[model samples]
Target: MTRVISILFWLSLAAVLAFITLPLLVVVAASFSPTATVTFQPFEWTFRWYGDLLSNRWLDPFLTSLKIATVVAATSGVLGLLAAYCIVYERLPGSDVLMSYLLSPLSVPQIVKGVAIVLFLSMIGFQGFLGTPALIAAHVVLALPFVTRMVATSLANFDANLDRAAQILGAGKLQRIRHVLLPMIKPGVLSGVTFAFIISFNNIPLSVFLVRPGDSTLPITVINYLEYSLDPVMAAVNVASMAFILVVIFLFEKIGGFSAQIHGGSK
Candidate 1:
């Protein structure tokens, strides 16, 4: 019965993997197709759709999205670290209430938040912020709760004896935090940053309301283009986006020493 259960588990895992991967495979194949309508003819495949990505039509939005995502990631990481430190490490008065407030955004639907932001901005006559400024703010808000939660979890799991030991050894509060606490939670911080970047880069619902003409994000631009036509170029764009996300994750993993951390944990 144990063997049978193990076999079932493996089969379920394979099924889940296939379900997630097959669509990405199809998108990759479609990107290589020679025509607008995806074809399976390998001999007819061309790189022309990818070449189109070099044009300003695509490049501008890509750059805008990159800039916004970078800003959002950095901003969210710093803010999250600080908030987590206060709530979990310092354990300030009313910490539970403060934490609930910080994480309130998570309970709200993104679409509702997006709409509320738009409405609030309009009412306040900050229409000028409708472009990049609004996008950055909205993305940061959307990403903050996740980042804070992750960092808080990391801090909660931290061994307090280490901090006490450092204190006993004459380490200042800032020194211990900078050297010990930061290094210990580096993985969770990087993971949160990476997640923030990806979400900001690919967000559509929030972006749609915030983006102005000629100041759109890559995801918004791709979606707008889709309204006009169904083309292989869209597939190529998706494939490139996935590749960029992978590269970002790889860079984060390197910075966080994730492999070394895993090895240390195993030991």
Candidate 2:
């Protein structure tokens, strides 16, 4: 029975892996396909789609997504750090309630939130938030829950003695934080920032609702292209996007240990 179950488990795992990886494999294959169309057997290699991507109107959308993601990550990371610090360290009254409220966004369907925001914003004399500062604001809010939870977990696992020791040594709150607290929780901050950036960069539902024609993001741009043509150009775009993410992940690992940073908060 044990041996039979083991084989079954391996088969199940293989199935899951294939299911997840098949689309990515197809996208990469399409990226390198010589022809404009998608195919399974004939292998064709070309960089023309990349060039096309650069020349096409997609450039504007890429830039707009970059701008919005940048702003959302920075803003959300800072806000999350502050909120996490307050809740974790101070453990103030109703901190549990506040944390629940903040994290509730994660529990809700993202599309629902997107629609709700659009409706409310439209009602409040704002017809559209896409391509505007307000859109970034919405992204930041969505990303905040993840960032705060990460930082809070890090804070929770960290030793409190460092802060108390600093206090004993005549260090003020600000000084202690600068010297002790921040350094101890640096791993959490790094993880939070990394996640916040990735989450904001990849978010579709919110971006879809909030982005205007002038401010469409890379994801939306890809969607637009796919809608009109089911070609390898979309595949090329996906491959390029994956490559970009790989480079960023490499940089992240070089600057700070990504594994340690992320797992540090797991406890």
The local distance difference test score of model 2 is 0.79
Q: Report lDDT (Cα) of residue 168, candidate 1.
A: 97
lDDT of 2 by residue, 148-267 (tens): 998898899878887788899899989988988887777778767777777777778877787776667888778877887877777777787768767766776676646766565233
TM-score of 1: 0.91
Model 1 ranges with Cα > 4 A deviation = 1-17, 40-43, 257-267
TM-score versus the correct structure, for each prediction: 0.91, 0.90
Estimate the overall C-alpha local distance difference test score of candidate 1.
Answer: 0.90
The candidate scoring highest on TM-score is 1
Q: In angstroms, give how far residue 95 of model 1 lies from its true place.
A: 0.4
For each candidate in the order shown, give its overall lDDT on alpha carbons: 0.90, 0.79
**Number of the top lDDT candidate:** 1
